[model samples]
Target chain A: MKTINLAESTVRDLNQALHDQAIECTEREWEVLEPKGQHNIACGLDQNISVDIKGPTGYFCAGMNKKAHITIHGNAGQGVAENMMSGSVRVKGNASQAAGATAHGGLLVIEGDAGARCGISMKGVDIVVKGSVGHMSCFMGQAGSLVVCGDAGDALGDSLYETHIYVKGEVKSLGADCIAKEMRDEHIEELSELLNRAGVDEDVTAFKRYGTARQLYNFKVDNTAAY
Target chain B: MCGIVGLYLKNKALENQLGELFEPMLIAMTDRGPDSAGFAIYGDEVPEGSIKLTLRHANEDYDWAGLAGKLKHELNVGVEWFNNSKVAIFKIATSDGIAEAFITENAPDVLILSAGQSIEILKEVGLPVNIAKTFNLKGMKGSHIIGHTRMATESAVTMEGSHPFSTGMDLCLVHNGSLSNHNRLRQELQREGIVFETENDSEVAAGYLTWRLKQGDTLNEALTNSLKDLDGFFTFTVGTRDGFAVMRDPIACKPAVMAETDDYVAMASEYQALTTLPGIENAKIWEPEAATIYVWERSSETGVK
Candidate 1:
């Protein structure tokens, strides 16, 4: 195992060391000590390595990842796993706003509650939150799956498209072009897989599904008032 | 964007180290707001019928003792003062209004930063580190502190435009977002006899709270009313005599994270400002919900437990 203490080294040093693995690929496991809530930790990594951050992180932790798996043991700041291509990011504690924002493909699991705008504008990513999510979760999401094992805040899944949203607890308010949909067998299967991948043990049947109503897919003159 | 950091020590044992712990928190947020920095510390209370005033002059070599001597001669009240950087802290055994009137008439160039029993505000247009060092912030002992670093979105980069604005006695506010209707609100508040020092939107917010408190509204109630009346994004941390309160606008675009332990309750715009705190690993950390008011006061029985 490789260890980098942030108290001694800067974030640039840590990212450079992690990025070096893309060419040589010698170290498969890494640990970061004293994360100290700094920004841009382990960002832009393309290697298939696992990095464990021992403390809370600042903005854009594990941002723009390709094939690396990152785990934050404490809370995460804004935009964790933003614009990721592939791989996984796990936040063991609560996350600030815009978790998994604009990520193309990856799996992001948040064990604690998340602030506003979780999974915003996501494309082809899968997110599972063990606790509640704040307002405007999954806003303008194009393609992804957001599974919440707990409650959801106001305006859930606003202007969504082709994204599956599963919430086990209460939803404060559904956003425009978003409504509760009937949970079919395929949705149940998909949610069960996401929950299992996120290591959340919950009954799949207890969840309700929400998605775009397909009315806003094309701008109709009748829908002008809603806009 | 601006950054706000506040620390309220619940344990009296940590009172002496308040500035030592809070100085780094403000310094860590330099990137967020590097235009200006300021803070309002609540400590060193004066006796009954006495108020402490924090005054600032552009000239660092201004004679603060001369001003105090003149104030004593005019107000007929014993006045004692000390200087910190370009600011001066004065303890006068008189009413806040009378002392302020005397200063405004006699020392026209002096800017009254704050006037209260326990609050002292110091602000300057500079980086947080330089401001901290110049003000000797590391040695300041206090029970609670509220600070701000400004990037100057709504107004100019002058010291008057900096945050931690005080519009009332022992009450101040630090904000992290812009208000859209401040110009209109300022006109309305001015008609109600609320005096504003600058065109900064944050000063208007502080004035609004002062107006509300004058209307017999509690801090929590005033904040709830602000959520409805004030437009635009805001994450405000307000410091009062007995306690402090935090509130964010309904949209909550501006971020605010709070952590509390047995010893203290700390808040900042991001987690980075709180990383240097002791026992933070075990603190109960959470993001304050949108449009919610969170208040912690130094109670008579158990203090800020």
Candidate 2:
């Protein structure tokens, strides 16, 4: 196992060294020895790399991520996989706001908690969080699926369009146009797929579903009843 | 628009106001509002009876002690003692008008804002470090800090109108959105002899808030009043020497996040701006409650866990 430790180096030095070493690590690299508030540590990776960040990160740790598989052992700051187009980021600890905001495509999994606006304005990103999200989570979401294993805060899925939200726990309040929806067969299948991808071991059948009721999708006089 | 950030170290509550917690975070975001930057930092270690002030008007001759006395008088209180700076620091908790009277006399466009217990305001057109350092910014020993970077959207980017604008001696305000009813509020407040120097709608906000604070109303009370009285999109953070306050319009138009750790708290205009703060042990983040005012006090030595 090749272990490049960042014992005394800042997140900046470690990232630079990783990039300079040209080590296209295939397996999970042993450790990020010492990381103090490092930001954008594993951004924009195209290789099939597996990384294990030893400690917490500052912000946007794997933003714009693609192809590589990454994991962080400790808590993470805001915008973890923001604008990511593909691949995966597994956060073992709680995450800050906008965890997977504006990702066109990708898989983001959080084993712990996430802050407000998780997956906000998400464009085709698949995100799974184990804990609660603060208010206005998934605001202005265009597409994709956001799964929450725990409770969701106020205004969940506010101003959403097309994006599907699956929450296993109780919801504090629904956003402007968001309403409860029946979990159908296709939804169960999709939830299972996302759960498996995020390494969530729970059975998909246990979770309830919530989504945009399509009431406010387009403005019209007749639609006013549902809106 | 300004890059304003602050964090109040409550034992357990949402993050906000007092200026100390936001230091470098807003500094990084200084590029967004580089015209000028000033901060109010509060700390547990600062001695009593000493005042901290930020001085930025280079063209004028000023009297620090005399200004401090005026601060004591107009606030309608007694001054025990004060510490002088290009920016002055006051350790005495006189009436609110004391600080305002001083700022009024000096006319350097001062901001009587603070994180939890310190007020510092500097007005100039430049980078963050340029103005912040002149007031010994990085050297501050505080629990939180709030600052502003000016983009000069509406009003002339003068030293007077720069954020953290002050109305009450202990209160300063920084804003991120336009006030739709500024003209109306301006007219109303001006009719009451509340003088304004610039066209920035935030000034109206500051004026509105300061007037309310002077009426013996709490920060939260004034902020709550703003929801109905003030129109348009706004996300504002206000700081008092001992407490921090925040308010967002009903629309949640502009962005501001409350992110905190056990020891520190942070608020910023964007997620990218908080990319440099320390301690994120499961850092839970939240948005300001729309049209709601949240106020918090710094964790004091009273040992109220």
Please list the residue runs of candidate 1 whose C-alpha ends up more than 4 Å from where it truly belongs after superposition. A223-227, B300-305
Worst 10 residues of 2 chain A by lDDT: A21-30
Model 1: per-residue lDDT, tens digit, B1-305? 99999999989999999999999999999999999999999999998899899999999999998999988898799998999989999999997489899889989999998989999998899999999998889999999999999999888899999989995889999999999999999999999999987899999899999999899997777788888879989999999887788898988999899998989999999999998899999999999888888888887323222
lDDT of 2 by residue, A1-227 (tens): 44555556555665554454346554445366445445677766665567788777667988887776778887777789999888789998878778999998889999888877899999999999987776788988999999999999889989889899999888999998888899999999999999888878876877888888777766688767895
Off by over 4 Å in 2: A1-41, A54-60, A73-78, A121-123, A139-143, A158-161, A203-205, A215-227, B7-29, B41-57, B60-120, B138-145, B177-180, B231-235, B248-292, B298-305
DockQ, candidate 1, comes to 0.85
Compose the digit string of candidate 1's lDDT tens values, residues A31-89: 99999999999999999999999999999999999899999999999999999899999
Q: After superposition, how far is residue B251 of candidate 2 from its true place, in Å?
A: 5.3
Question: What C-alpha lDDT, on a 0 to 100 scale, does residue A213 get in candidate 2?
Answer: 77
| Model 1 pairs in collision | none
